[model samples]
Target: MKSLFSVSVLIPVLSISMIFNSWAQNPDFPWPEGKRMALSLSFDDARASNPDPGAALLDEYGVKATFYVVPSGMESDIAAWKEVVASGHEIGNHSLYHPCSGNFVWSRNKALEDYTLERMRSELSAANEEVERLLGVRPEVFAYPCGLTYVGKGERTQSYVPLIAEMFLSGRGWKDEAPVDPYYADMAQLTGMEMDNKSFEEILPLIEAAAENRQWLVLAGHETRTEGNQTTYLSMLRKLAAYANDPANGIWIAPVGEVAKYVKEKRAEMEGNLNIPGISRPAEGETIYLTAEKGKGIGPDIKYMPEWNAFGWFTAEDRVEWDLDLPEKGKYEVWMEWSVSDEEAGKPFVLTSGEQTLEGIVKPSGSWETFQKTKIGELALEEDFNRIIVASGEDFDEGALMDLKALTLVPVGK
Candidate 1:
């Protein structure tokens, strides 16, 4: 007779297989050839080491990486840089003069804290023009100087992220903890993880995690050498390239701009296939309702309850998201129709769209069947396509959060 432990293990194994099959069929971002995730290798500062052995090693492995260059730094290595471009690598702007915060003693004279938005804008444009003139290919992506993105200081400080968003197809930051979510990440501020001075063993876990989440991993380094400070080891890179090249690993490795362009195209396709009516500008005094049936449910536990016309079985990990296309920017009052038993009350949840977020605690509605409408807060949304997500907060315990019926948005001062 089969052992009881064997039977128990068999059930979960079959369940996991089914889940994987379902995901393979309908992924959030359709990667080419059913690849699990994307990887982008990028280097910054236009280091001389990049063109010598860095690009050569990558060429041997059939890998394309992005090199963010300061035009002034490349003047001495023009021929090698040209060969890099001809070899099919991408070039991105790293800004002229490479301004950073005054906190760094070296950058004190060219500090961003002393610059105005107009001055910063002019510098960025000049860098792009110079790069195009020198390289024959316009830099379409950017990496923030020292990963800092602000002008001025104190209350007068303003972020230059908007400037980057307007100028480049994608802008990258350094020392980020996690990978980019292909569906939700802001193209202007993609996270760039550090790969310098790390061994293959140290970076394997990150690659595995990104593959598990089907996210995009953009690894950034300064130099590519055998062994040194702030360097990506050639040995480590060789191992990584071999691992990614194998068909079993299922990774799509390419340059930053290439992966960014593919993500944009895929996102547009997903939005067009949503099939739900787009949210447009309502007449004055009208409210927009996002119903449960219209919203997309993510995670394994969240499910729709047709009888109650709501989404139920919500766990801490579950999320409900909606897409909206607004004609103009406006401030709106936010409300929610939800139901939860007394035992599950006080569970916190957060609703977020763009950079705006509204946090609220779940109120007991006597029973899950009894729905109550409550005004949560107000938010100012930007014009164009916006993705809104409602997810459980950190305080959420082990239980159902709420049965969400609909979300309401009323234009403020309408």
Candidate 2:
């Protein structure tokens, strides 16, 4: 299985350590390894239709999937759940109660006090307890209940994921598109790309595309058999089975948890080093930090500040920029690290530029917020300069201010 992934790791090696331990984007992330492989299907909500009679379908066909389960809803089907585990499907925590609201709510004391984390862990633990009790195995993968996109925004309600659980499982269902950021252990977390009743015709094309691109795809579902016929899903499974089983196609099927495990293994091999020349040269044991300030609200934590953009509205007083430069023209992956606790009490910073942007929230806790890193984007270098500039995307009140830390640039060794 490790052999199939080598195609993805093609960047410069020895230089990785320098990238990881820097203040800019760690160029060492998304360690290039093995051929481009796409993760197969995944289902959310622990639907009743899972572990279909076609339990062996994915593995027999060489495909893998992650099943985000809400134990409260599927507690009665222990046998079916066991079969799913026995057959090699990955089970992930989707929150104990699947609270539709309060998805982004978090607290500094989550692991120690919040019910969300405690209940989530308990629910997942209990589910794992049940699985181990029945199937003799414990589950690890975890998916956000509502694809909650947290970027250091809002009050203490925002749940902060402790580092202790970082390696628990691959992160899943973060969004509905291909993930480009490697800041996360498993950034490929996607949504609704498959289900029991969806047509083979509808699902096959996406699978084919992901395989061709060596990308990961996630399919989400709710109450699959709880409401519809199983034939379409069965047929879709059969088709997927064929695609996964065909080694010539280069598709590796595993549960989301399994995929996360694989990523952890591979990343461990590279050991958190990014290898881009010139822009960022992170040495081993170094770290990068990025900050986001306030502006017009884009989502929750993200703001639409024009001061950072070259085109946005801002004068000298409303502007902030970075000091960095690219070496050559080619593909590049960029990441920015951010800490919410660093902002002034009750103050959140809005960071942005023509292409780079982020927002960080400062809490009243006074404790420095932990680091949350994010990949900015992959750029096609067209020129070179002494120092690249990163500024605020928009203007803010004169009283408002944005801070600076580090800017990293990586030349994608494409």
TM-score of each: 0.70, 0.50
Which lDDT values do the candidates have, in the order given? 0.83, 0.46
Candidate 2 residue spans exceeding 4 A from truth: 1-35, 54-64, 102-127, 149-154, 160-167, 179-197, 222-232, 271-414
Q: For model 2, where is the 10-residue window of minimal lDDT? A: 1-10
Model 2 agreement with the true structure over 195-277: per-residue lDDT tens digits: 54677687777776665545566666543342375232656677667866666766555566555556667656653243212
TM-score result, candidate 1: 0.70
Best by TM-score: 1
Model 1 Cα lDDT, one tens digit per residue, 1-414: 422111011111011122211011224467889999999999999998999899999999999999999999899989999999999999999998899999999999999999899998898899989988888999999999888889999998999999999999999999999999887789999999999999999999999999998999999999999988989999989999999999899999999999999999988876523323234444444687788756766666776665666776555656777887777878888889999999988776777776566666787998988999988877777777777777775534478889988899989987
**Mind sharing the TM-score for model 2?**
0.50
Residue 306, candidate 2: Cα error in Å is: 34
